[model samples]
Target: MTRGYTGEVSPGTPADVRELGTLTISKLSVGPMDNNAYLLRCRATGEQVLIDAANEAPRLLELAGDAGLAAVVTTHRHMDHWVALEEVVATTGARSLVHADDADGLPIPSESLVEGDRVRVGDCELEVIHIVGHTPGSIALVHRDDAGGTHLFTGDSLFPGGVGNTDQDPVRFASLINDVEQKIFDRLPDETWFYPGHGGDSTLGAERPALPDWRARGW
Candidate 1:
């Protein structure tokens, strides 16, 4: 189901999904930018993965609870994305993980991830894909569930109506758009659910129709 910035995806206690095997991806709105911080949980094993700890440290810590926070993954090293990372790691004692290209932004040491790198949390395995338009180290996490649906965690590379901005170099924006079209847009199934770092969740099917317009608009 598509979710917006309204209420939490699953309010109260966690809800279990048979196919996902206790997996939950909760979005936390943070900073003045409305950056998205995801809380991924493995229901069976109670293992968790926190993505982009931007802010709201107290709430994040409470959300993590006693689960074994396996890793803290960052899509890039932008200040808005990594600002609260140190605080989250300190509170949960979870190791931080980022692409080798973006590892310098983290407060602590981080492992370099690449396209084929697989991160396991409980029964779920997230495959890493590098789509470097927004930043040199931008990455997306793709997970194939037993229920036959694909979940894509696109940090800042691809969004609902646009792509990540090329703040450092305008030329890189073209490369970023090309990467999203070839690597992410074309590879995933039409039904794939896209969980972006900002805005609401949309499907590959929903976003596909707008690609040409986005490209024309130079997004």
Candidate 2:
């Protein structure tokens, strides 16, 4: 159903929508950092879940429309990723979900999430994947459609060309790359399409060849 989802977004721009079989995904960029916020709505039940309330509470709420939101999943503890979290949660009264390791950083208390857990939007389910090293609690959501197409919402963990910034620490870089390679690259096929916290999107197959270069650069 995604006629032309280029995944290119910027602050103040309208969200781009992608309609999967059972679920609809809308990507919006907000804040000065251009942090992406995804709104997932279930076509069958009209239930909705927001991936991140990065900023622009009013705009995000507007994007949610009458259905509002069932929950907001913060990908990490980074400040930019949750600038509008308090406002969105306050306005919608939606449940807040964050990794246990980074829950303390949030403005409001949230349900602790971990690997193997699933977040539901009506009948659709998104599998949680805990990717460490980015912030000790960064997580990505995986949604596989009925047609076998896979979509990944990678926070600041995995990106187009390489893993997230590890602050130039070799150990952190190692941890991130290793977990990304094993937990993501090893398990998922090359056709997997990934959406990131900022900018455009890319497929695993397009980025697969650069795995060694990213690991070797130690970024």
Show the colliding residue pairs in model 1.
22-43, 133-176
Candidate 2 residues lying further than 4 Å off, grouped into runs, are none
Candidate 2 minimal-lDDT segment of 10 residues = 140-149
RMSD (Å) per prediction: 3.6, 0.8
Best by lDDT: 2
Encode model 1's per-residue lDDT on 78-118: one tens digit a residue.
88888788888877788889999888767778889988799
Question: How many steric overlaps does candidate 2 have?
Answer: 0
- Runs in model 1 deviating more than 4 A are 1-22, 168-170
Error of 1 at 8 (Å): 7.7
Residues 86-189 of candidate 2 have per-residue lDDT tens digits of: 99998888999999989998888899999989999999999999899888999989999886489899999998988999998888889899989988999898
Backbone clash count, each prediction separately: 2, 0
